[model samples]
Target: MSPNLFFQIKILANITELRSLIIVKQLLNSTFLYIGTFS
Candidate 1:
């Protein structure tokens, strides 16, 4: 494989990881809020 292709794939992987982290954080925040409201 070419260096350029590898670099692109690495970047894509990082972006995907970052997006999933953001989503998980949002979900956690919402869950905490719900618990706080009811308890």
Candidate 2:
């Protein structure tokens, strides 16, 4: 494979990782908020 193609794959992978991190953070925040409200 070409170097350019490898770079593109790396960029996409990084973006996906970042997106998942953001999603997980949001879920954790919501969970804490819910628990706070209940308690």
Candidate 3:
């Protein structure tokens, strides 16, 4: 594959990784909040 195509794929992978991380963080925060409320 070309260098430009490789670079674009790398960027897309990074963005997807970042989005997943944010979603995980949000889920954890909400879970903690829910537990705190119950206890």
Candidate 4:
């Protein structure tokens, strides 16, 4: 693949990873809050 295309793919992968991480963090926080309320 061309260097430019490779670089673009890498950036896209990084962005996807970052988005997933944020989503996971939000899910964890909400789960904790839900359990806390029950207790």
Candidate 5:
């Protein structure tokens, strides 16, 4: 495979990872907020 194609794939992977991390963070934050509200 070409280096350019490899680089693009790497970038796409990083973006996907970042999106997953953000989603997880949001879920955790919301969960904490819910617990705090009820506690």
Candidate 6:
């Protein structure tokens, strides 16, 4: 495979990882807020 293709794939993988991390962080924050308010 070409170097460009490898780099592109890596970039895409990083983006997907970052997206998931953001989603998980947001979920955790929301859960904490819910617990704080309701508990």
Per-model TM-score on C-alpha atoms? 0.98, 0.98, 0.98, 0.97, 0.95, 0.94
- Total residue pair clashes for candidate 3: 0
- Per-residue lDDT of 1 in model 5: 100
Task: State the lDDT of candidate 5 residue by residue for 1-39, as single tens digits.
Answer: 999999999999999999999999999999999999999
Reference-based lDDT, each prediction: 1.00, 1.00, 1.00, 1.00, 1.00, 1.00
| lDDT tens readout by residue for model 1, 6-39 | 9999999999999999999999999999999999
Count clashes in each candidate, considering only residues at least 3 apart in sequence or on different chains: 0, 0, 0, 0, 0, 0
Give the per-residue lDDT of model 2 (tens digit) for 1-39.
999999999999999999999999999999999999999
Q: How far is candidate 4 from the true structure (C-alpha RMSD, Å)?
A: 0.3
List all candidate RMSDs to the true structure.
Answer: 0.2, 0.3, 0.3, 0.3, 0.4, 0.5
Candidate 3 lDDT trough over 10 residues, lowest sum? 1-10
Per-residue C-alpha lDDT of model 3 across residues 1-39, encoded as one tens digit per residue: 999999999999999999999999999999999999999
Candidate 5, residue 11: how far the Cα is off, in Å: 0.2
Comparing candidate 1 with candidate 5, which one achieves the higher TM-score?
Answer: 1
* Alpha-carbon shift of residue 14 in model 4 (angstroms): 0.2
- In the predicted model 5, the residue pairs found to clash are none
Q: Give the per-residue lDDT of model 4 (tens digit) for 1-39.
A: 899999999999999999999999999999999999999
Model 6 lDDT, full chain set: 1.00
Worst 10 residues of 2 by lDDT: 1-10
Q: Output the worst ten-in-a-row residue range by lDDT, candidate 1.
A: 1-10
Residue-level lDDT tens digits of model 6 in 1-39? 999999999999999999999999999999999999999
Off by over 4 Å in 6: none
